[model samples]
Target: MSTVLETRNLTKSFGEVKAAKSLNVGIGKGEVVGVIGSNGAGKTTFINMVTGYLAPTEGDILFDGQSVVGRLPRDITRLGMARSFQVAQLFPKFTVLDNVIAALVAAEGTKASFFGPFTTAARRKKAEAVLEEFGVANYSRSLVSTVPQGARKLVDIAMALISNPSMLLLDEPTSGVSIEEKFPLMDTVMNAVKKHGVTVLFVEHDMEIVARYVSRILAFYSGEIISDGPPQEVLRDPKVQELVIGHHLDISILGDAT
Candidate 1:
């Protein structure tokens, strides 16, 4: 498989603290990879740097074989890379359909104005289609804040995908979703992404979710990757079990589940 994204000696620092240290990794086109780490383990920092939300103190990011370091997030989005936040980033007051229409406007790179005639009938039709694809069409008339967390997350992912990005980075996609809802939500997301053939890198705290969704895993610990391999191999690594998974997950059970 060809590489879709790569980082070389990526580093980020806040004064004396290094949130991400010399990180180097590559994601293949169409690969579904999961990122696992505890809080402050540099997972978000890695995503932030890759998406241009935070300028790395050192190293380069390549997207679709072009250097993207120092590029703005909007520029990166235009380059076929888009991301969703850990918390669903949405306009709480706007109805779900309107939020999607707004994303469509942003994706077109047209300056949005309160008095501008941006939301044409074509835009509304496209937004509704996207909502239906993500299985959130029922919540279209509801305010985002009034929707369930899982639905809100689906909306956020849909917005990221509005630009037809080749790569989608999801930060803690299952976080805040109820346990019963997590699998179905992810199934919708995974099925949609697979249909579009988009590469995925998601940060997840749920072991079961990670195990089921990703073909490979990157285990992060203290600003570095402790293990990188197939889910079973990485989860079974002693270093990963000791440092990342810790006492919370039993490796044997995870092994059987996979």
Candidate 2:
């Protein structure tokens, strides 16, 4: 249970708006953590900063005990961190397999040579394996634009994982997926992460999914973490219930359902 990621006084601001305020947290290797918040609560800001998509205004980020401040996203990926976006980041015109091949090429730092001999037998094998792993093998030959959103989300995560990252951040993995498909999508994702032993930190809006999939929960309100602990404890907290989970829905129903 060693700390694989840590943030100290992590702060981000845009003009007068504070997106994240003095955030401090540590994530352990192989742990599955969920982040929950309403709009503008700084959940995405934390992910962006940790994954190097956005630089913090001030404070520090350490991955595996080394400072990663000011590092580019690609450099951070090379350091064994990878992320899937809330909106699936895919080349819509590319075939599902080709998209993964492109990711494989980029992960190899050969983006310039991507079109040339990049889809060799070995690379193709790897890409196919990734597609199968994410349960998107059936869509391998289809254009990304033609696939369902759930399949596209799987493809995006597959591409991120093809790099063999030790830690993975998923922004709303179940977003845009049908209610019936959410559990299956998460099952596929969680199974894949377990197979690779990758630490996971995901931002999700659905309390049921978060409670089912994550070992720990971090509740955010007004750009600060208001609760952090086990699912039952955090979800049942008065502040979390009022500010994040709310009393409108019977949380007990969610607990039983999950």
Task: Name the best candidate (by lDDT).
Answer: 2
Compared with the true structure, what per-residue lDDT tens digits does model 1 show for residues 1-258?
Answer: 999999999999999999999999999999999999989999999999999999999999999899999999999998999899988889999999999998888888888784678679999998999999999999999999999889999999999998899999999898899989999999999999999999999999888888888999999998999899889888888898888888777555455443
lDDT of 2 by residue, 143-208 (tens): 999999999999999999999999999999999999999999999999999999999999999888
Clashing residue pairs in candidate 2 are none
Candidate 1 residue runs with Cα over 4 Å from true position:
252-258
Provide C-alpha RMSD values for all models, in order: 1.4, 1.4
Candidate 2 has a TM-score of 0.96
Task: Assess each prediction's global lDDT (C-alpha) against the native.
Answer: 0.91, 0.92
Residue 114, candidate 2: alpha-carbon lDDT: 46
Off by over 4 Å in 2: 253-258
